[model samples]
Target: MTKLNLLLVIALLGSALVLVRTSYEGRRLFAALDRAKNEQRQLDIDYKRLDAERQAQATHLRVEQVAREKLQMRTATPAVTQYVGDRPHAASGVAR
Candidate 1:
């Protein structure tokens, strides 16, 4: 009967240790998941902010402003326009 009691105590201690280890693992996994979710939320917010900035930058007025200011571009006018008369190509005898 004493040997049986010792065996039972050993089994009970092993079970308690397994339970504790699994509970600790569960808490660790839950904390990792929470951190991942917070990171995802922050990334989503940053993406939205960058998307808004991109939209603002891609507006027609912004494009025109950049073109004129940075590229020194201007609207075409007849005074500055040049036209070339088509001549027959020597290789294909074509005017296109």
Candidate 2:
């Protein structure tokens, strides 16, 4: 009878150990999943911010401002422009 009791106690202890390990692994998995969700949320926020910045930079007015301010460029005036090179000229009197 004492031997049977000892065997039963050992079996119960083994079952308890298995249960504890399973519970621990489940909790760890849940924690990792939570962390991943938080990271995804943060990345979404960063993407939105970058999209807004891109939109602002791509505006027509912003492009013109950058061109004028950074490159110091301006449109051509008719008084300062001239047309040339419309008609072809004959070659000089030299053999080919």
List lDDT for all candidates, in order.
0.98, 0.95
Give lDDT tens digits, candidate 1, residues 31-92: 99999999999999999999999999999999999999999999899999999999995796
**Worst ten in a row by lDDT for model 2:** 80-89
Best by TM-score: 1
**lDDT by residue (tens digit), candidate 2, 62-82:** 999999999997768997778
TM-score per candidate, chains pooled: 0.85, 0.74
Clashing residue pair totals per candidate (backbone < 3 A) = 0, 0
In model 2, the runs with Cα more than 4 Å from the true position are 1-5, 76-96
